[model samples]
Target: MPSTSIESAAVDGRARTPRFIQRQLANLHKAITTNAKIIQDAIVADTGAKLREAQLEIHLSISVVKELYDNFSVEEALSQEYRVARGQDWCDRNDAVGTIYLRPQSHNLVYSIVSPLANAIAAGNCVVIESNKPHQALSSKIAEIILQHLDRDTIAFVENLPEPPSKGVLLIDQTGEIPKINASSVHTPGSSARVVALVDRSSDIVSAASSIVQARTAFGGNSVYAPDIVLVNEFAMKEFVQAAKIALSISIEETKGQDITASQATCKIAGIGLTEKELRGSGANVVMRGDLGTIAIVEDRGSSLLQRKIYGACLILHSVRSLDDGIDLANLQYGTVAPRNKTLLACYHFGAPEAAKYTTQFIDSYASFVNHAPIELTVGPAAPIGFHPSATHRYRPAMFSVPKADCIAGDSASRSLASIFRAEAKAWSDVYEKQITSSLAPTRQKAGKVVGFFDQGLITGFVVFWVPVIASAVVGSGYGIRAGIRMTRS
Candidate 1:
């Protein structure tokens, strides 16, 4: 286990403060930037991710740290003004959501964990992270790095997710296995997902196949965002499949450069929890590099591939009767057949933009890329989200914080952030002016229930008891407004 010194530090009163949170984040940033190469090498050695992929994880991790430091501020969070259209008659502020347990999905290791970790820190909450699966070792290294910079209480790591804290926890389970919603999920479940890539007759078969091939073969099918079952218009099936095979036919020597031994590639494919035979059993045609050079392509009808999250280098090409049929099938697969949003991503490559738009409406997915696949080859730690429906919240610092409303109800008040700030300055100035003058202080504004009256230097008010009125208004508003579209130009 990594040192729990930070956890030990948790008992200190200051550990929960915003300043300590900022210091922890700054130290984490320093560690990432200082030891980027060591972390990258560790990820590669542990995950079998290519050098570029591992490097991307490290690069992204550093960027997220920097982004969090620049954006999420403790002082800023406390003072956020939820300006009401009623023009300062009411307002809201943010309260720390409280200590959050960040459950990072281990599939992508650094990429998955770091994003939420940054947010949790920014929200000014101590976080306990739970890491698991193939990336457990990588998780430990991250904890080790974090420990060097952060005190134990500010951040801690556990082997498994515990009972939810009083404050909400970030359940970053990319596997779609989070029993209930936590903070977020970068990858939803694919156990029942079916990919539908529409390749019309007029579609660029070569481009479609190339992108899909790259997505499928890229990173050895670990990417949940990749297409599992491509829905090619029946008229273009043969051409698309042919193009796909050609795309995967890149030289064996080139594939060999990835440094995977033939022994691993030729494994009973059964051992990896997925095999071509099972996929073929569904009436799909198999195409791959000779002697199983890593890439595997299966051509089948849409019905043949459903609810199967295949691991390894395999792409499934399925035929659809028509674009409408494809859309309906895609819709049916994601809508009724699959639980939750089974399809994480759908890529449509077609000449008819209108018809493609119709397909996306029916296909239940987090994101759909028109004329493009969801495989991003950028140099950073990343996950496919924000564009699609996710079970988890956006990887933002705010999700870790609670918003407690500090409402000031009045008929009139400062109308803008600038005005309110100016008033606050004046209030402080008035206090100093009285102190220097050494005169009997003016009757301070006495604000209270039962119509209490008071006056300040520049302000006066009759404080009516607002308790019962507000209580009734809360219930009255429900019955007061009719449900309909109403647009107002404030």
Candidate 2:
């Protein structure tokens, strides 16, 4: 039934006015507020996130909904006046290109969906949030809860949202990923999470190690944004490891996000004094053969770890020569199109402001943090870092629609960029009008008779005399005032 309604919406691809979209979103918001506890518990039950973390996600979701509901306007979406453009001179006008199909993520599912969902709603287009295997139950539950309140024709809820339709697939990239801007792929960003904590030699060892452990244990290391590896200076590898072990309060067996269903791999190589080659070599014993959910403080020995993605509640410790070297290694490992090819956020920690500034120039991600890691579930107390990159940058509401340039000013003469330019243009225009009028004062534009003054270039001659004359008079008067002041002083 939902599919049929939604398919009908697709025919026109213009189901919503801005006010209607906001009103529908407000209904969803009211439903969410009324069923807040159900949603929170659903997230916890579905994703294994702790209660507090689940609460934060729900709060963020509600915030986004309210923000979109209040901020979105139908008239504003279609057209806006450009203040400087006088009238009919210049402005920006937005046109909804087509429909947007939103896809939820595999893990941290609720937090993931809130961001893109809010944006799609704000973009004021036909929005459909369809579910996949991981999101089947939750999506069905949400569809059941929220669908009744939403406009079925304008916005649809597909309990099992299918693969994106071939029509109006907004993205085409050589990167092989179908562009999250269109539909999220089966391999979500969580699969290739690469968060490295760059600890410089000058950093306080205990503070650095404790904070690193605190971040990984945040939401029990379930977030894709959590630290997977700690790359510290080789100068402090020993002291750092001891402090980190104290801070890591849980055993490797207790790691939350590990798939008990999948086989665990670890190795003797995740030990002291293993060489770089030994760690990366094909020898089975030297490889990390089992899941090291516990902290493993190995030397900066090369491991398939950097070359691969680790989603478990795991932290691999490695040493680097300098903070700059750590940045280089992170970029090599986590930068887009790099070996791992998926990193949404990266962080750099330095002791001094200068050091932090110097190191930041090379770091890359959809978002980057200095002095602090991007570790929080949401921007509140437990994890103090306050950036929501996905909602803010990666999938901004701006992406869903395109703003076009328009002219609203009177005519070409009134379209000047500056006040002076407008005045000059108006003055010249008036003079041209005056000249034509004066020439026609004695004789009118007679039938089949060319205006003799126009043919004699009277208007052009007037323009030539008056334009520079007005300009020079203004310039000369300004200069004359300045010269008079100087002479009086003399």
lDDT of each: 0.59, 0.58
Q: How many backbone clashes does candidate 2 have?
A: 18
For each candidate, give its TM-score against the true structure: 0.68, 0.64
Best by TM-score: 1
lDDT of 2: 0.58
Q: Hey, what RMSD does candidate 1 come out at?
A: 20.5
Worst 10 residues of 2 by lDDT: 262-271
Q: How many clashing residue pairs appear in each of the predictions shown?
A: 16, 18
What's the distance in Å from true for residue 132, model 1?
A: 2.0
Model 1: weakest 10-residue lDDT segment is: 375-384
| Per-residue alpha-carbon lDDT of candidate 2 for residues 64-174, written as tens digits (9 for 90 to 100) | 788777777767554453344435534445545356665555555554555555666666566676664564776666776776776767666656445665554232111
In model 2, the runs with Cα more than 4 Å from the true position are 1-4, 7-15, 73-90, 159-176, 179-193, 204-207, 250-293, 336-345, 375-394, 410-490
